[model samples]
Structures are given as C-alpha cells and as structure tokens.
Target: MTGSPWYRDGRMRYGVGIEDTFIPQERIGHRKLDEYELTQHYARWEADLELVAESGAEFLRWGIPWYLVEPAPGRFDWSWTDRVAAKMQELGLRCIVDLMHYGTPLWLENSFLNAGYPERVAAYGRAVAERYRHVWTDFTPLNEPVVNAEWCGLTGSWPPYLVGDDGFVTVMMQLARGMVRTQQEIAAANPAAVFVHVDAGFRYEGETSPVPRAFLDERRFVGLDLITGRVQTSSVLGEWLASHGVTAAELQWFRDNAVKPDVIGVNYYPGFTTARIEDGVMTPVRSDAAGLRDLVELYSARYGGVLAITETSLVGTPEEKIAWLRDSTAELTALRDEGHDIVGYTWFPFFTLVDWLYRYDQKQPDEWFREFGLVDLVRGADQGLERVRNSAFPAFRELAIRDR
Candidate 1:
C-alpha cells in the first residue's frame, strides 16, 4: 500500500488516535484503567494497524505505554515499542508518537505532583527519542495537560488524588514544567523532531452571571498559556497560581524556558466543546460547523501555526457518524480554502473503545462499547475480539482517497 507520508514532510495528514491511557487508581483498589487491555490492543496490535491503514488514514496517534516502558525508575523496556515501531515503518504508516498519554510509572510516587516529576518524565522522553531518533520525527510530550491536572489534582481521580485549588495549581505547574523539559530533551536527542502540542479546545457560555463565565473562559487557556510562556505574573491564572502556592519565581522559570510547538493540535468533541450553564446546569450544545470553524480561526490567530483536528468523533449510530465525517471534512476544507493553514482532519480511535465509564470501573453491560471507530469490535466465534466493519468505514475511506 502506498500510504501518505508524515506531517513533517509538508503533506496534509489524516490520522486515527489509538486509545492508549494507563491510570492506576487507588479508589478502585489500585486497579489501573489500561485502555490497551480494555480495547485489546495488546493482543491485536498488528491487526489493529492493518485496520488503520485499510481505513485510509495516513498517520497514527499512538503511544508507547509509559508504565511498561519505565516499569521501575531507570529500568527501560523497549521490546514492545521496538516491534511496533518496526511494523509501522514497514507498513509506511507515519506515527505521531504520544510520549505520555495520561499516566505515570508506578515507581514515581505522587505522579505529576512529585517534585522530580518534570525531570523524571523528561528522562524517559529523552531515552525514547535517542533510541528511536532515526525512526520517528514527531511527538506529543503530554496529552491534555489541563484535563490531566483537573482529574488527578482537583477531582481526585488518579494517583496522588489531591483535592483543592492548591492541588490543581501544583499539578498544572508540574505538568507545564514536565512538558517544557520533555521537549527540550527530545529536541536535544533528535534536532529535526516536530512537537505537536495537543489540548482540549472549548468555549463556554454562562446563562446567568458574568463572573463565572469570565472565570471559565480564562481557565480554558491555562494549559496552553502556561506551556507557551504567555501567562503574565498579573494574569488571572498567575494570580490564582500565586494564591495557591506557585511562586512568582516558579512562574518565571516557565516563561524563561518556553518551548513553542511546531503544530497546534486541537481535540474537539462537540459534546464537550460548547456548553450552556443554564440555572447552574451544564448542558451540551448540539454541534455546528461554526464551532469547528471558530476554533481553527481562534487558534490560527493565537498560535500562528499549522492546525490539525487531532481527535473528533460522535458517539452514535453508523449513519450519524458518517454524516459527521462528511460535515467535518467540509468545514476543514472550507477553512483551508479561506487561507488558513488547516493541514489535517482525523477520525480518532481507529477501532472501537470500551466505554470511558469503564475507567471508573462502572460495570454496565456486555454491549457497553463506544461505537466511534471506523470499525466495530465484536466477539469472534472463538470468543476473542474481531473487527466488524461499520458504515462509516466506506465514508471515511472515500474522504481519505479524495483528500490523500
């Protein structure tokens, strides 16, 4: 198969996000929510890669499971990663390696809150980059830093589950530092590497008062702002960080050692992007082309870099997903025609995923899979998993053929 080249080659990219999240929870008795297990990516990785290529996607948003990579501090395991990277190269599939998804290795107690979190994560990143330096050229140091901070720090969802604004500030600062250091180490290892900084893009509307609305709007920019060194000492976020325990000197460190991304990646889920706070109840506003267009415009103006829809999918029937694929492509093409450097559009999760609720160990039903993939996961006659083609497959394949 003659697949498309990676984004750094100046070609527009169409990709799929392989679901890779490893979060060890103390609440569920220290049971980890491993997406690779839930999605059976371990046993079926090769077949999964075939599915991604068959679906016509040019790039893969995949990651090396961090827990397995650095099981113990300084102990590195490259067997699994070595095999996967070799296969991806042989298959002509460009990989946007997600260096850290959402979890840390267990040996690193306190996770992101650890004082050495930045240095430790950067060490792991440097090892991977040096080892695979000649093979891969793109990476995402940490996925959704703000969301990770909120869940692990403010909401008490993961390890070192601290609850308070102080926890949030602490985790955010550590995450920012980790990102900066990780990029630095990787760049030192592979000077030609491209860093794609990805985060959840959102806009909020308060149905009642202006105070909360203004707060939420500013808060949305916390992760990106901190990473880009755009947060001023007197800014709303800086003040909040100062009151919560982040020193002025600490904030200055990030500003002084800023790492700009080669590409700005936006993960937009209509169900989460736009919301209304009516009578203090948050409701998902139906998705529209305007929201997607607005994001491309907003980010292009702010970051002034090539933009890619890193992740976008609707959880619904096959026809609905197909419709979304067509609509999203139109919006992206329109943006490109309007002179914006919109370079890519992705339909994430090349195959099905276990319900995200499974992360909380919420046992629902045997049929609880989230059907957002181009193909569905089904039980084979031997009771193992099988890829059952969904209606959206042809729709996406058509778009990929035309766009590619």
Candidate 2:
C-alpha cells in the first residue's frame, strides 16, 4: 500500500475510503477485546473492505486512536498498525492514515482545554508518521474538527468533560497548528504525500450556512479556515474570538502559518442531517442518499478540490439504508455526468462500527447512529462475531464493479 503510483486523468489517482477499520484490540490493548472474540470481527471487517476495494477504490481512510498509539505521551506501539497496513497492502489498497480522530490517548485525558496538548501530539505525530510512512500513502491530521472541537472542548459535551468556551478556541487553534505541522513532517519524509483536511459533512442548525438558522453557516466553514490558517486576531471577527480570550498574536500566527489540505475530504453521515425532525426522527430532506442529487453538486462547487464523500450512510432500517445507498450511487454518477470533479463515490465502513459515539444508549437514543453501517454486528458461538452483510452490500458490490 505504501509508495504505490496513483493518478487522476493522466496523473496517478484513485478514490475510496478504508472501511470498518478501527481496532478495539489494538488501541486500548487486548483488554477491550479477547482473542477468542476477534476471530470473526477482524475477518468480517477485512472481507467487507476487500469487497469495496474490488469496487475500484484506490485507497482507504482509517484512523488509530492516540490513546491507543501512545499509552504514554512519548511511548508508542507499532505492532497492531503494522498488521493492518500489511493486510491493506495485501489487498492492493493504498491508505490515507488519520492520526487522531477527535479523541486523544487516555493518558492525555482528552484534554482539549490545554494549549500544550497539540504540541505534545505533534511530537508523537512526527514519530507515527515516520513509522507508518513505510505503509501508508496519504494522511489526515485530524478528522471533523468543527464537531470534534465542539463536542470535546467548547460544549464540554464529551470526554475530559470541560465546560466553558475558553477551551474550545484553544483546542481548535492548537489542532489547526498540529495538523499543519503533522503534514509538514509527513511531506518532508515522503515528498510526494498529500494531506486531506477531512471535515464532517453535517451542518450545525445555526447562524450562516446551510441549516435553517443563520447560525448554521456561521460555523459551517469554520473548520476549513482554522486548518488553512485563516483565523486572525486583529479583525472585527477577532473581537468575538477575544471574548473567548484568543489573542491578536496567536490569531495572526495561525493566519500566517495556515497549511492547506492537498485534498479536502467531506465525510457524510445520516445521523446529523434532518428534514423536519418529524416525530423526533431525522427524515431525509435533502440527500444524495435519497436520489436528491443537488447536494453532490453543492459540495463540488463549495470546495474546489478533487472531491469524495468520505462516509455516507443511510443509517437505520436495513431496507431504507439499502435504498438510500442505491440512490446515492446513482446520484454520484449524475454528478459525474455534469462534469463535477466527482473523483469517486464511497459508501463507508463496509461493516458496522463499535457502536457510534454520537448515539450512546443513554444519550440521543432516537438518532440511531449505529445502524448506518453496511453490516450488522452478529456474533456466533463458533465464529465469534460476524458481519451479517446487509442487502446493500451486494447491490453496491455489483455497481462498484461495473465501473471499476
């Protein structure tokens, strides 16, 4: 998977995300999962992925938990990563490695409130990049900064559980800096590498952007600019930032130091979007997953880069999910016909995830996040856990191959 030649048009290129690839056994150590339990879990994940690769996906995007990577701030693990990378290479798939997918090493305690966290993360990042450079091609420094920052830092909604807005700004800026730095190191080692500034595809129902309220767009593109170094301290907007204690010097520094993502990844999901929240269920209002093709064109125009929908799922109800996927694929084809840089389309995870973070049993019970996957997590006494592949699997397989 490392150092493979990929190209777009005449240049080397490919599209597709690595699916159902996070490991429970590796990051937290074998403590969370037993060897006896993983036999089917690992196999199913690999099988579904191979199926996606067969659909003409050039590379897969997956992450390693920081908590799992470095048990201590400086210490690291390479064994689990090596095995996964090798498997990907065996399957003839290149990989886009995501360093921290919103969470940090448990030792860091998910400390978004601290300014120093990102710096330490960068040090660890440099090491991880050097190690994985041998196995992966591209890299994503942080995934979904807007929501991640909000959940982990600003709103005090997630782990490390801090309250107040002060931490949010600090954490986001640090991440912006960290991502730029991570890409720099990775680029230095592998001069040909590209960085994907990956963003969650959902919009907040507030201020400026797409959501009904003006606040929706208010924070919509916030993540992109932060990573690209667009936020500054001296402007009118800087005043608002100052309310949270962002200083002029730091803001200017970030603006001057912004690092642009080589490819901007738009990761989509079904859970966050809504029609009218009818009866508290987020019905599909405007969705490519529903054959309502405009969103594809909207995104293509919004971000002028080789575009790919990183993760799109029709969460809940196997039948609905299947129908949504079929619609999404067909709509993607339409976008391609319209000459959108529609590099490639993807329906992700290929398998089920470790129960979604967004949908906890106690929290957001109505959202149904776990059902977005293409497989059902079922364990058999003899087989361990198996991915009872959904009906959409065969349909997607058939479509993906037709073009691949």
Candidate 3:
C-alpha cells in the first residue's frame, strides 16, 4: 500500500475472493443466482472478511452488484457497499473490485444488447470510482468477456438469448466498447486506478477443421486483443469478426481508444480449463501444473505484462485441492524465477458457489453447490450455509505465509 503500487513492490501477493455473481432472473423466469445472498454473505460479510484476513492473504478480489447499487437509472445506493469498503480498509486488504460481473439492472432491457449499454455502464463505473477512489485502486471493468459472450450470446442460456457466430460477435463488440468506456471514465475520476483485465484462460486440443485449432487459439485472445487494439482487418480473428458483421469503423474505434491492462489476470481451473475435441465433440480433459505453465507462457509471450492468476480452484476432495494448490503455486514460482512478471495469485470463491446450472435446473441450492474453496459450505439446522474449514485452508495459509 506504499511506494510503487502493489504490482511493482517486488513481492508476490496472495488473495482470496468470495463468489459474487449477480445475474438477475427477471428474463429467465427463475430465482436470481446471487452468490452473496445464497451464501449468506449479505448478513455475514464482516465474518467473511475476517476469514479472508485469517487466510494470510493481503489482497481480496471482491465485486459490487451494479444492478443492486444502481437499481434505477440515474439513482444510486451505496449504503451496503460503503460499509464493505470500510471493512476491507480496516482489514488492510487491497481490493480488485469487479465493476461488472455479467449482469445489468432490470431497467436495461435486453441486457448487454441494450443500445445504451456502453455509456450506461461507463457512467456506473465513473460513479463507483468517484465514491470509492480513496479506499480502492484496482478494478476489473468486466470479468471474462469470452464467457460472457459464450453464455448470453452463443449458447442462448442468458439474456437477449442470441445464438451462433453472429450472436457471439454482437455480444463481444458491445462488451469491448463498454469495457473501454468504463476504463476511461474510471481513469478520469481516479488517476491512480489500476485496471486488471481478467479473463478465463481457455485451451483446446484436437483436429483442425470446421473450427480450426489455430482459429480457436486466436479467438481466445480476441477479448484482450479487441480491448488493446490488437485486432485489425488484416488479422485472422479480425477477418472472422468482419465476416460476422463487425464493421471496419468499430475496429478502428477500438484502435483509437485502446486501454491496456496493468495486469493481465488469467483465471484457470485444472479440472475445467482445457478441452479435447474428437469427432467434433468437445470434451473437457483434466489439466495439470504443466497446463498452467503453458498458459502463463502463452500469455506472457503475447501480452508481455505483469500477470496474476485471478482465479483457480478444483471441485474435489481436500487432498486433491491441496495437491493442485501445491503444484500450481510451484509452477508459478518457477515462472517468476524465469523472469515473468507474476505478481499475485487468488484462490477464488473463498467458499462454495452455486453452479450456474442451478439457474436452469429445479433443484435445491445445496444440491447444486460446488466445493472449490478453502472452506466447504454445509447446511446447518437453520438451513443457512455454514463455512467449515477444510484441510486446504491450512495448506494455503502456510503457502501464503511463506510466499508473502
């Protein structure tokens, strides 16, 4: 919190995050999948912050539900977030605030496709920056653009449900524009704000054809490339974007106002980050520390900036989780030794999270919960999810203490 910004402090910071997905169910006809509400975080946030500090972590990756804070256009409420920000300061936790995490206020019809999305989201970002400029300095304008486009656009699982290539391109363009505007507004409000553009690090292995392996690989960088002005009409991905209706004017717009991230945070899960294709059926293959190394190398070679493992965890037994933590951290250490600007690592969720499928399924939240945190969530007599420490908690704490 002193001299040159946390990233330039010459120390590897460790952090933990509570799952804060706030996708409203107004358009889907189901209960909202608010992680904080389902995990009782709204009531027990103080205790949750205590848990984060107890983990020997100096940083916390947290989020604000823009939909809740700005329930109606031009109206703002900071009562809840005000207290949360104060507590993080009191705990001495450096926060990487997620400004938009895949949801919009109900008033904005058609979700991301709303014609007013870019400016509206930018205004929200400016408001948040003005309010919390003194307490927080880092922000993720939007988390995982590819995943956002995948769920809401390509798969038609969420709002404005469009499908296929056109939908993906449409959603990506909107997200890219909104993200650029958000960064610009935040910087105008707080000059010291640091942007950590986080995205899911995806890997695919298989035959090249209908969707060539090279195209799939290049597509992974489209989210970052578009925001940083690396996409042009001459590039393979840019050409694909053009075929899907992206105008040359739009590409030029990105090039004119590119906002590069101070830190490129890549979220990867050994169990879910990689996929193998055979006969055109994509199947997820379990990855190892080597897989993470490949991604870190890939990002470092392409983006060439300070990097962080923004999110990593496994939905398995405590022993399995501990093994992953050990292996992945070791790989990171080696990367650091090799001169990669690896600044931080985060064990996301902090506790269990209700899987996204819960939105479409008719099952109790407990049944849909995934155990991928330092602590496990269990239903108590009062039916509230209780955070019970698992073996990985101590293992992670020891690692954090040693690394820090």
Candidate 4:
C-alpha cells in the first residue's frame, strides 16, 4: 500500500457494476449490438450514475463505446465520454473504465482477427486516458477476453465467427496484445493509472476419465497466462498454441511484451460460472462460498495481485439475490481477513439490463425479464423502461456502509 494508489489501500473496495457490453454480429451482417443503448443507459445516464452513487459503493465498472468515440480511424470524438467523466468526478464514484468490452467499430472487418486490432484499440485507450488525464479513471482495456474469443472464434456466436481451434488462439492472442498495448498507452498518459484485468473466473469439474481436466484447466488460465507472459515455449499452453496453428512469432511476441495486471478482477455469477461435468455433461455447481474461496486462492497464488470480486449477481427473486450477495460478501471478507489481497466486491448491474440474446434486434423484453440487476427493468403502461428498485437495494446499501 505504500506505493500503490489510494484506492488500492487494504480496505475492501465495494462497488456497483454498470453492465455495458457491445457485441457486433457476423450472423446478421455487420450490425452493432449495444447493451447500454438497449438498457436505456444512454437515455438515463444521470439517473443511473445517481443510483450507483446512492448504493454507497466506491467504484463503478463503467464502459464507453469505442466505436462511437472513434467513428473512423485517426478521427476522435470525446463529447459523450467528457460528460461521463465529469459526472463520475462530481459523484465521487471511482471508475474502472472498460475500454473494449466485446466489440469493435464497423470499419474493423474480421474484428479481433484484424492485424491492426491491437494498435487500434491501444490508440483508443491512449486517447481516452489523455482526454481524461485529470480524472482518476482506472481501466480495464479488455473484459472477459477468453469468453470473447470462445464466443467469436469457437462457437460462431459473435462477429467474424470462425469455427476452429485456430480461430480461438488467434482471437486470444489479439486480445492479449491489445491488453498489453492499451496498458502501456494508458500508463504513459498517467503514471498513476492502475488496471483491473477483468476475466470470467471459471472452475471446470468432472469425472477424471473421458475428459482431460488438465487441458481444460490449463486452457482456462491461457488468456491471463499469456497476458502476464507465463506462456513459455516449453509450457503446456505454448505447445498447445504451437500445435493449433498460432505462429511462432505470435507466441514470442506475447512472451516479449506481456503485461501483468494491477488487480485481478474475477467476474463470478451463480449458474454456469462454476460447472461440473459428470459423464460428459456439464452442470452448474451451486456453492458460492466454496467457488469464491477457491478462486481467491487460485488467483492469489498464481497472479499475486490485489484481487476483486468484480461481478456477481443472481437472476432470481430479490430475496434469492440478496442471499447470494450476503454469501459472496462473507467469502470475500473471510479471504480478506485471512490476509489475501481481496480488495473489492461488486454487485454487477445496478439496474436491470436488456437481454443480449436478442442483440438489439428486439427493443425490450417481450415475454419476461432476465432480471439480473438489483433493480428490475419493467415496461411501464406507456411502454418505456421503468427502474424499480428491488429489496436487494436496501440490503446492499446497508452492507456497503457496514463494510466501509
């Protein structure tokens, strides 16, 4: 804590998550998919910020659209983000700016596969940092890179959909490069800048036979390992990448320019975040405390950085969500007391968010709500989005104050 920023002081950093992810569609011909716009965040920015501040959380996992700001290459616009930066300062909410969530601008064809992707993303990160030099905005250059790669490269669910192991490695490398470059640029702009490397923390369990648990386990850490330069030529992941059509130069580049994270931000959720494979079928394992403790230990031993429960929320009723939040906080507090650098806890998505399955094709939920936020997104009689604070609000509000 001596040299680290004031925010990283050993005190637990409780925060509210602002769910903002934009995914482009290769299935639907290069169209943009924005969660913020779909969730009415653009229309209710001030209200949303107020809700986060009023929740008594110190940090907000915020995002701004790179495609909107950098409409075209070398041409930048800071109008929208300028206002956001000012408001965050006024509200006393420290932000962990998510520079690239999951998508790119329309101009960047093949998305993460594009050779210029790393440089382009780095440029945007640098521009944002320089523009907001006075504001103490921490950055998450890329969020959930492993999931981004798997969805875009392996499953053919997202843009530039490529269905193969080669595509997966390619996307992962591109993301790693972008993260490293973006960190470098942001740090150059402000030496005080800190980065919370956010990734989905998963634990895959199953029968020892039929499935190679070691392979899946090693693969889980590949994204973070590569970013931190842990993938040596003789390493299991490096060998796997070499066999999977990733060029020798690409592997060497990651080794040469790896960037370690300042904070290890683990995005944990209820279902499917921790899964078990029994007889080749995968299922969710429902023990938040056990999962959270294991993750804190794993990351603490492997990465040796200040850790954070960056995202955790349930989609059930308010009581159920509150129960999960309490359990999660207990685990995090236990870890912190045991001398682990577990610095923060976050209730992701302060309000209800629109479903990503529709990907902006449908305006709002027609049938029922996903209901993942502390507040519910209900359709009013006039058909506009209404923010209804659930029982979890007061509970989390009190918890945040007690933790501080």
lDDT of each: 0.81, 0.59, 0.90, 0.82
Tens-place lDDT per residue, model 3, 143-219, is 99999998889988877688998999999899999999999999999988999999899998666456778888999
Rank list by lDDT? 3, 4, 1, 2
The deviation in Å at residue 218 for candidate 3 is 0.5
Q: What does candidate 4's lDDT look like per residue over 179-293, in tens digits?
A: 9999989888888788889989888765443557888778888889988878887788889998987777877887788786888899888766887876756678765678878
Candidate 2: TM-score? 0.79
lDDT of 2 by residue, 170-212 (tens): 6666677777777777777677776777776654322322224
Q: How much is 187 displaced in model 3, in angstroms?
A: 0.4
Cα deviation at 33, candidate 1, in Å, is 0.5
Which segments of model 1 are wrong by more than 4 Å? 1-11, 26-30, 208-211, 278-281, 362-367
Candidate 1 residue lDDT tens string, 60-179: 899888888888899998999998998888887878899888888878877887889999999999999999876788899998887888787887777678787778777888888999
Estimated TM-score per prediction? 0.94, 0.79, 0.97, 0.94
- The whole-model C-alpha lDDT of candidate 2 against the native structure comes to 0.59
What value does the lDDT take at residue 182 in candidate 2?
74
After superposition on all CA atoms, what RMSD does each candidate show versus the true structure? 2.8, 5.4, 1.3, 2.3
